[model samples]
Target: MAAKPQLPPTTVFLLKTRSSPTDAYEDLFKAPNDAGSRYAPIFVPVLEHRFVDDGLAQIDSLLTRRQITNGRLQSSTGGKYGGMIFTSQRAVEAFKKVVDGRHASTRENATSSWPSLQDVPIYSVGPATTRALRAIKLEPPLQVSGEHTGNGEDLAHYIQEDYAGWKRPPPTATDGTASTDAERPGPKTDAQAAPLLPLLFVVGEQRRDIIPRVLMGDASESGPPHIGVDEIVVYGTGVMPSFAEDFERKLNETLGSAVRWVVVFSPTGCDSMLKALGLLDPETGRAKDLANRPRTDFIATIGPTTRAYLNDTFGFNPDVCADEPSPEGVMRGINHFMAAWTASQ
Candidate 1:
């Protein structure tokens, strides 16, 4: 009769915020009988949400400027908006805080153009973001007109293709003329009435200017086509001052303990975690980061964007990058990693 092979547990690091795939990783590491699972380590979480400061105050200011005078709403820009862009659910929730009137409870938040400007188009980057829009009861419960673009570059290109000309009404209701039989009015098509007002980008503090940079052209360029881009910072992001003492302690519990796997959600978070773990110097950051870490360990990135960062910045191609950018997708990546890792072992 064959005996069960008992082995020391491996240590795994996971850097992600709420709603990430941390749980999936936890479940995968629970069983030690699977091939290569013998080396499956105990998972440790070092990720935490950054302190969201001055978010509600900023939202209130935008709300104040968008005061509903009489029955009509007047915006700070003094014209109709071309459209709206949202890259993160954090931006959506910030707008939710103000629109839903939850200012007293939240610290960080998003911005709003005007309830009357509901006729304008709203674009989102991810499926979670699409769900956030539907949660706000923004009209139809789906993404409305555009395709669900998971990539930021794709989203930027789509916006440029759809709204660059600023022709035709930018679709009144998100669900195609409102779901109810309320007989919604038509979109404003009179070009002379409005000067193709800038689009409102509801974003967080850690945002990348991919959309604006791509659609509006060179940042250094000057003159009329400078493009009207009104950016509203709704949420804040920052890393922990240091990694958790408990995590460090666990790593040192056994002789020569080391991380066997790591899961990162973003490129920023990936570098941030390396810094937190002292793998990269805090002072004079390294040009070739993660050089000191062992080569045998595996890293799993949440999506292609983050994987690109790892490839470009650290010269480290992650062992796996989730194809769909979802919890299930992440699990699939882990499964694939296990299959290959098991074969190698």
Candidate 2:
């Protein structure tokens, strides 16, 4: 019998900090999707984050004073904000510190440390951030939403609808006196009604304004009522000093196996990432000899935001841009691209 042709080994380098226990990407690619394929995944930490004490203290005050609430339920004593927003895992980590502090201080109490804010809606951008928020140890727990949206712009639109409906009065049951459904009607749309309280957005120093803009921007003639927003920067991000060295070391280690894909999670580390890959030129700061580069070695972005950043800043177009910012979304895009490439070859 003749021997079958051997295929090149495939490896994927994820340029982001890995989540504890298990990262979604690591879990997704742990096993090959194909019987004939082999994939080795490596994580390269790109950014380091630190919590800001001032911002955390402000959140602690708000929770301590019973300031954040759903105005409809606690109208008399509710604070100025109705809910909270989270867009990144780092911000959630910072928020968790405040939560842990409160829990420690009130360990002797019979009730949850977070009493007034338990029922308030807590909006999250995607599954990763939602997971971080969900992991917080609260007594009654958090009411997290927008995990399905997968990005900021989509999550913002979802929040507008959900937050509006949340503020509306609950339905009333009919007494024996009334015979019609209108007599015991549900909450009605109140165009002229007072707007809901602002949402306290806890975010990193570097973040897009899409959420706040969409939720708090001017309401269109036909759109939902404009919700107010307040932002508190609870964390700051910076490229890890050893990113280039670490990334290059990983790439060299995987030299025996063809590094098939480099996934960029954020725009913060693109320059260093590309430089470490030996694809970026030293002077012009652009991709070098694209026509001669390995066709099988590709770059992928988490979503359109990073794609846009690479295109606009470096004039480099990534091979794949995941439609959604999730592990499944990235996998789908890569699979589709590989299928099309194979056909072309």
- The TM-score that candidate 1 achieves is 0.60
Off by over 4 Å in 2: 1-9, 34-36, 72-74, 113-115, 167-192, 343-345
lDDT of each: 0.57, 0.80
> What are the TM-scores, per candidate, against the unseen true structure?
0.60, 0.87
The C-alpha stretches of model 1 lying farther than 4 A from their native spots are 1-13, 20-78, 102-118, 137-147, 163-195, 218-227, 242-260, 269-296, 311-315
For model 1, residues 6-89, the per-residue Cα lDDT tens digits are: 555665555644433234445555554334543444544443344244765665564456421111112123433456778876
Q: Distance (Å) between predicted and true CA of 226, model 1?
A: 9.5
RMSD of each: 8.5, 4.6
Task: Kindly list the per-residue Cα lDDT of model 2 for residues 1-345, writing each as its tens digit.
Answer: 999987754688889988976798998877667534455678999999988889999999988888887663223434678899998988888888888888888888865546455678999988999998888877578989989988788889999889877743332223312123323457543322445778899989898899888887888869777888889989899999999899888877777764478989999889988787777789999877787445647899999889999988887899899988898888888878877777776
Question: How much is 159 displaced in model 2, in angstroms?
Answer: 1.3
**Candidate 1 lDDT (Cα, 0 to 1):** 0.57
**Span of ten consecutive residues with least summed lDDT in model 2:** 171-180
Single out the weakest 10-residue window by summed lDDT for candidate 1.
67-76
